[model samples]
Target chain A: MKKMLAGYDAVAEAVKACDPDVIPAYPITPQTDIVERISEMIADGELTSEYVRVDSEFNAASTAIGASAAGARIFTATCSQGLKLMSEPIFSASGMRLPLVLGIANRSLSAPLSIWGDHTDTFAERDGGMIQFYAEDVQEAMDNIALAYRVAEDKDILLPALSCLDGFILTHVQEKVDTFTQREMKEFLPERDPVHTLDPSNPTTMGAYARPEHWTETRYEVQRAVKRSKDKIGEAVEEFADVFGREYGLEHNGLLETYRTEDADVIIVALGSVCGTIRYVIDEYREKGEKVGLVKPRVYRPFPAEELNKVLGDAEAIAVMEKDVSLGYQGGLAIDLKSALYSNGSRIPVLNYIVGLAGRDVTKDVIKKVVEETKEMRGKDPSDIGLEEEERWEPLREELLPGDKDD
Target chain B: MKQIRIHGRGGQGSVTMASMLAKAAFETGKESQGFPSFGVERLGAPIEAFVRIDNKKITDRSQVYNPDIVIVQDSSLLKLVDVEKGLKEGGMIIVNSSEGPGDLDLETDAEIVTVNATDIAMKHLGRPIMNTALCGAFAKATGLVDRESMARVIKETFEGEIGEKNVKAMSEAYEVC
Candidate 1:
């Protein structure tokens, strides 16, 4: 049913519809609202899940791992410092092949503390063996909760998954979301039947120590599993469309959704909530007869390289806009985009724009500037575009930073 | 899309005002969105919230830089914030104050309307909170949302005796405004 709901509340509703057996999560900004709603649902007798109150995010993930090992479907959430604290157990969860859903209200990491939204926390754990899905808005965020659980619990793809929503941008924003009924959700995602479980009477070793002989093979198996989960992700997305009757990834695969890219020359690639602003800007440019389009990555972990190339191959230039920077390198999406496209043998001029860090507003002006800069790279040598010594900080205030360059 | 920005103290329910306005608009068959400022809010500190209403899906997630309407729940925020900043030329401002528009001395081409929401709230709800009263004034002044829908949303949000009292304050403020 369609209801006006906050992003967090919507995700919590989705979680309730999925009805996990156990929920072990600690409170953190942005993410706090989601867990709070679940707590209320459990308290009001609307849900019967075992809500585990943990001391920290570390215990949250550890408890999730233990519960999932005992054949209980699990759900938990955290962000930024909380995610950093939970990283160790998260990796362990993946290595142990425990399938559970982890909700991440994507927030910026801190030396200088900030409680705002960004993708730094999610990208920091890119190496961790878990599936990642980035949502564009509240509806997608809600849908992805079910999708993540569906894909995670597949007997073939028994890996932890993250349903990431931008902190305040989507988490706090209120919008109309169409949530599924529990009956529909149960049809789409049935109760988990684990391939392996921890029974005290007949205890079997899981995530055991790997020696030199077994270490390489075991890690390779995880790598292979993640690689194989891409198809499972696609299948789940298709099934979701059949059940919910909403095609999240229309005309394109569920991995990378393309917006108005049929004949566009400059296509901006983005993840999460910024895609909405880019779509607005694209409409503005379209009014002026500029063929601008957008490609939003719904699935980030399997990286959607081949699917992205199919839609982006004909574009004159590509601009990658992201909320997190890799510090010494370009934004994570840009780095991944370049590598992905290059491997596909498409040497398109790709412009990397680092924007909206720590909840800084990425307005239409920033997106327009990206398009203008990307337009300049249409026929230029790819090597000549980013020749400047320093990274390009779009919409940067030179006066505030102690920089010599005067604009 | 019609954009709106609300300014108030942290404890005064500015965010709640934004969300309620959006919900009212949604009740009237319009798509709406509401979100709070990125600032870390503390009680009594100034904070801002935004609302957008349209016929179609509201996709632009950027903070409202140009609002067609601005609502000031705490008139004291005038000294600290440019509540009129980026207001459209022919837009409107609904402020919670007993003073006339000329006395507020805000430098803007937009029209300013005042409702003594504090007095109305104190009379009906026995509190100084002006969110419900200001929302009533906002509905009466702009006509973007009807009083009936606003009252329904207000009642849906705050139940029992408190809801009826807020609706009373709202109706009184609406009458005066």
Candidate 2:
């Protein structure tokens, strides 16, 4: 359907089209609408699913675990505090190898009580054993809902997947989204296959406690599958392209979306809706004869180390702009990117800019300045205090971020 | 791209107005996007919402620091915030007020157009949800969106008498503008 749908409603509609067997919903800010819309669908008899509203996110996630173990295809959504409240169960869902999908509207965690958009929620879950796909906008969120199922429920990759999107920024924003019919959704993503589910006749032991002797191997198994899930992600994206006629870095390890980076001397790496702003700045600079480009890493987990090397190796310098931080350290994404580059033998000088935390707006002007700063820091050791003070640029951009007085 | 910002109190349908404008633009086969500020504050707080429409797809997700058009669903918002921040030169300002251009107390090179949207909405919609009515004036003052598309979206949004009444209020203000 050609329609204007908010990312919030779009995810809900996509979930409806997929027709999951069970949805255990618990409402939270920014993500509450997805649940509300799904509840409305169930109420209208438009969808026939066991829609259960639990008391909290923890309960919702726990219910998903119970449902999935009972051979039901489960789905749920949460953000920020809700995600933290249910973190343990999230890891458990993946460990149990349940082919479930969790829709995440990424939001800021709070000591200050903010209900705004940020990646702090999902970034905190980087090691939750669940495969993660970060969507850029309304269209991506809707499409990835269906894609998440295809990747999650693959026979070789019976792992839980989270389709993460920036809260409020993308969730509440309305844009023209092309929605698919149930027939099309079925063609793209079929009903979940219960490969190793709880069966009454053929009873199997599941979620049993592992002693010290076997705990290592059990975790290694999940870690190994987490790494191997990339191939499954690539295959799902390839099949999706073949059927839906839209491509999303399927050839590039289904990892990074390299935009105008082919001939650029400088590039900024970013994620989510902020990439939308970064692309605009890159275009503006390009019009003025600046060789600026952007590489948006869509898959944060299974961090695209090799792809980053190949795509960003030729750049003069690179900046990793992120909305989530590690507090005493640099941003989570920037640190991961630096590690990715180092491991891949790419000697590029990487700069980290922490931006848009707690729903702060990263405007075109902000991104443009970041590109300029990265260009100036080219070929220099960012760790050298003398070089940093000479140009007066903080590698972490402490001055440019929000919630601080001076900048 | 034509950028439009709507300034109003929280419950005055500021974000809804922005969404309808973008949706109407989409219905007319233009690429459009709409968003409210990240602050989901209390009901009476002054807030800003934005809509961007273009011949080609828009990629910028930044807030509209400058807009070609400004629609004031509640004229009181003009005093609370910088309603004219970054308006392009010779921009258009549409206000929901009984006062004429000389009495609006707004300083800008924008062509000032005022419609008593509250009066129109109260008459036709039986309440002061002046967003739809302002869209009507927005159509007449700027012609960014046609009145028919605005009515179609409004009707599609609301159901039964409410939808008919919203369309009626919007259409009446369109002729009045």
Candidate 3:
């Protein structure tokens, strides 16, 4: 049951256990190994599925959409520029209400060109109507695949799902993963029985054109279903724990997870593999009698606002460390958390620390520095630390940024 | 937890060496993780990989900055990069070279262990794939993983005659260490 597996291989193992009806293959850094393993499984007769070879990620998404429309459970993976190339289909796949699970080896988008770990890819598609789940480690990356399928396929919440794992960090790192048998996985998630599909005999239109009159209502319905999916996802995670014997989220099966935040004064909120690093810093600080904790949001879409408020609101100061930026604004997660706190009528000092971009190492020392800064910002206004713009590039190499020729 | 860093050229199997070490540690009933540096690697380019072994689950995803031990698969990398950059003061480094520890000019507080892994590999496998041989030297020098566990993983990784060749090269390097 326990084996040494890289995150990509672990994801492939989960996909094999789930046994989707169709797999469209496209190669990209980090995510390519996952589909490569799936193809090997199909070719080796271990899995019975239609393995479609596609030249581009756009075709991969299109193929998955077509297969899902035919009432077939679908599995596909892509990230970064590939995800951007599949942007149109990604939106339509979710809009058409296909229960396809998209595995994203989260990577930074390129202009200067980078093939490293970041949240930019998935966070860019945050509003595309797909349910988003960010995994903290190799185990969660594998577990999220099955859990995303279980939740996304629910008739009431028939939205596509994105199971995102940090590129290279988790995808390439080999660690212990407790794999599940096909029988046990099937017991938890039975075969997909779609509520609607494209049938010629009993035809039902999908991805139909929405007129101006119907556009608002269609958008409303999608919004309503996504908002309502929070409960469905919570229930599915509980059932997943019962079936798989692996429980997620600290305290309970909420969208976000809390680590030692019950009595902490300073807490940092982050997502994906970086949370593991932050947890280590928390443990080290806790031993030194410092009330430092971490709040990791496993689910990004349906944005865990209320849950974020619950775990982080009690802290004297909250710092949101993220690998993404909203460009000219602040880190995406920090922007959202600040809005959520503001809506909850809480005036906590939340500092935004943008870090670990383009595979820059976010070491324990960087985290320790953030904690110290958060400690300094305690009980201070946003402007007090020159954070009114909500941007703090912690650990930034100043010379790298465009500045004056001389200091 | 014990952290290890491996320095080698891109084609020298540094990443595989790290993974094999971690797997060997796992075979000894310890939790372990291994991964390559986030570098744009190509053949013959200098690169690094890392491994972490612990009694409990290894959760930190950061690269091994302060390594408890260092492994250099190429003697050339000694002049190219700081192979012992963040090594602990009393840590040890296992280098694959024909020269003695005195010949390799590395100024560090760590102990230096040298083995001519290329010769061992050329003798057994007819190639310069010194990763397995260096792994054997690692086991002998550090005793972090036993020889039996290291051989088992090497055999599992490289099968049939190649596996046997690798094990022989490993044992030869182990004896030299």
| Best DockQ among the predictions, by candidate number | 1
lDDT of 1 by residue, A1-407 (tens): 88799999999999999999999979999799999999999999999999999999999999999999999999999999999999998898888899979899999899788999889999999999889999999999999999999989999889999999999999999899898998889889989999989998988989879889888887888898898888887788788888999777744558878888999999999999999988999998999999999999998897888888889999989999988898877888888888889888887999888889888899999899999989998976567765573246777887787766575
lDDT of each: 0.90, 0.84, 0.89
lDDT of 3 by residue, A1-407 (tens): 98888889999999999989999989999799999999888889999989999989999999999999999999999999999988889788777888889899998998878889888888889889989999999999899999899988889988889999999999999899899898789888988998888899998888879889988888888888788778877887788888888888634455878889999999999998999988899999999999999888989888888888888878889888999999878888888998899889888888888999988889999999999989987887654656455678878788777998697
Please give the lDDT score at residue A271 for candidate 2.
89
Model 1 per-residue lDDT at A66:
93
Q: Which ten residues in a row have the lowest lDDT in candidate 3 chain A?
A: A381-390
Determine the iRMS, in angstroms, of model 3.
0.8
Compute each candidate's TM-score over C-alphas. Answer: 0.97, 0.95, 0.97
Off by over 4 Å in 1: A386-391, A403-407
Order of candidates by TM-score, top first? 1, 3, 2
lDDT leader: 1
Give me the chain B TM-score of candidate 2: 0.97
- The better-scoring model by TM-score among 1 and 2 is 1
Higher-lDDT candidate of 1 and 2 = 1
